[model samples]
Target: MHIELDLNQNDLEALLHHCQSFTPASGDSREDGRLADALQALTEALLEANASQ
Candidate 1:
């Protein structure tokens, strides 16, 4: 699945903050792992976008 979002500085910061704040109990579930991976990917993409700007 592909998703697209157009986030400004504040939006991106909020997203990063939320992702950083998230904690999955025990970190043992498959869904939790997937969410963690997605968050990491999103963070990397956001960093790359900022670097290119």
Candidate 2:
């Protein structure tokens, strides 16, 4: 299944940047991890909905 992301370019770029900061070798970055988790959950939900169709 495929999913189309409907986010503004700036917001998406910001999110990508935020997630980039959460690397395992980086600083104690739980906050960025939360952001990444939320993004993944949201994407999964969107993709699952399309798969259900």
Candidate 3:
């Protein structure tokens, strides 16, 4: 499965902010790991997109 989003600069910023502020519930190591990976990927993608603009 795949998903796509067409986000403007503001939207991307807001998403990054929200992801940065995310806190996983206590004792949920799996979720915490997933969130961390997602945050890293999102940050990288945002940086790459910004650089190409």
Candidate that scores best on lDDT: 1
What's model 1's overall lDDT? 0.80
Give the better candidate number (1 or 2) by lDDT. 1
lDDT of 3 by residue, 1-53 (tens): 34467889999889878777777665889988887888788777776777888
Q: Rank the candidates by lDDT, best first.
A: 1, 3, 2
**Global lDDT scores for all candidate models:** 0.80, 0.59, 0.78
lDDT of 1 by residue, 1-53 (tens): 66667889999889888777787666569988888888888887777787787
lDDT of 2: 0.59
Output the lDDT of residue 2, model 3: 46
Q: Which rank order by TM-score, best down to worst?
A: 1, 3, 2
Tell me the lDDT of model 2 at 39.
66
Q: What is the Cα-based TM-score of model 3?
A: 0.68
Could you give candidate 2's per-residue lDDT for residues 1-53 as a string of tens digits?
Answer: 54567666566666556554544433558865776677676655644554665
On TM-score, the stronger of 1 and 3 is: 1
Candidate 3: clashing pairs of residues: none
Residue 34, candidate 2: C-alpha displacement in angstroms: 0.2
